[model samples]
Target: MIRYPAYAKVNIFLKITGMRGDYHTLSSRFMRVKNLFDTLWFEPKSTPEFEIRGNFDCDVRSNTIYKAYKHLLAATRSDKLSEWMETHAVCVDKRIPSFAGLGGGSSDAATFLRMCNERLELGLGVEELAEIGANVGADVPFFVYGYESANVTGIGEVVERFDEPLLDFEVVTPQIQISTPAVYRYYREHLYAPIGAEETARLESTPSRTILASMTPTEANDLYGAALGCYRELNEKEGWFFSGSGSSFFRIKDEE
Candidate 1:
């Protein structure tokens, strides 16, 4: 079995760029955390069904990896994908925290998709895999592209690689389980103030390290306030920056 590392990511900056229908469009810089990742591989299936071994609270049907599989099958009815899964289980050794704004689930799903594409020889390109991933989750495409840093926009479909210095990040995910949809709903109903095109253009052009130096936690991530308002348990510390929606905070590894 070939093992792949599904790295966690931090939002160096996440800004709300209006809404596209019910979806909240965003312009965010996704930076991979080098040391933190989940391990995914294929192993012999122990039972009669498609099995995933991981430390997940949700059942098999509810898992995003399964969703990726279903979507992959729908996109390309590859008999090889179906045949391969019948005997081998998709296994994950999870290290990234779930629902903590770290893109753990999305990363896992993307990794699984890549594994399927390579193992089953699905012949899907990065863009093709990413399109399939977008259906799995908003953050999955970032992982699918596998850039060190990238600007993610358009309700999470647009991903352009940004030439930014990759800095080690220290992540802190509270034991709190944040519901991303709930936070977005709260923001939509209560705290929605979308950025205009000029500001969006500025954010897209700026480098992440510069953004970190110039902005505070609340300024860096638009979802931070809504996440705090939705989940009272999430608190702001003096120097930490919020990633994605909520529950996890991060900082430069060497920052004092």
Candidate 2:
């Protein structure tokens, strides 16, 4: 049985650059939450079909892991992947909170794709895997690259590794409900004022710690306003930096 970790992540800073079709383009720093992650592995099962044992609230069709499987299969057209699944079942030990702006689902999907590539000897490079992961979800590409810190841009299809100390973060997710689509929709309709390109370049180049100290929660994350607009309960994020879309917030560990 091969076990792997699907790590959680926090957007140290998320700034919307523009829009491509209905999706919002962004240039943001994605830092892996090293301490928090979900575990995945393949266990022996005689089940004659694809089996995923997990705490997922959604069904197979909506599951990101399943979607990854389908995409991988489609991309490779390899019978080995299907044949291997027939003997072993996929199991996920989930710890990351779903819909909490932690990239739990995307991480899981990306991890699955990586696992397949490694185990099957698919000969797919990092870039190839990232490309495949983009089909799964926007966030999956970042996880596919498996970087400690990266600048994700261009609707999340572009990921560039950023050099920085992996600072520990204090992550919190409030029970208030929020969706990425809902937040973007509200932002587009009610509050859509994008920052200038010159400012965006400056923010992306600045260190995350400095930004955390200088910028307020609203200033750090462009989606925070829309999040507040969509869910009135999320009015003030207690002046902490907001993560992607909504509901979760984080700060450097032990920083005042």
Best of the candidates, lDDT = 1
Residue 93 CA displacement from its true place in model 2, Å: 0.9
What shift in Å separates residue 197 of candidate 2 from its native position after superposition? 1.8
Query: Where in model 2 is the C-alpha error above 4 Å?
Result: none
Worst 10 residues of 1 by lDDT: 45-54
Model 1, 120: alpha-carbon shift in Å? 1.7
lDDT of each: 0.91, 0.87
lDDT (Cα, tens digit) per residue for candidate 2, span 1-256:
8799999998888887778888888889998999889999988898777889999978977999999999999999998898988887889999988888999999999999999889989889999999999999999999999999998989999999988888788888888767888888888898778667998789778877787889888878888888887887875757567889868888887877
Candidate 1 stretches with Cα past 4 Å from truth are none
Candidate 1 collision pairs: none
Candidate 1 lDDT by residue in tens digits, 114-214: 99999888899999999999999999999999999999999898999998789999999888999889999998899889888998889889887788889
Error of 1 at 206 (Å): 1.4
> Against the true structure, candidate 2 has what lDDT?
0.87
Q: Estimate each model's TM-score.
A: 0.97, 0.97
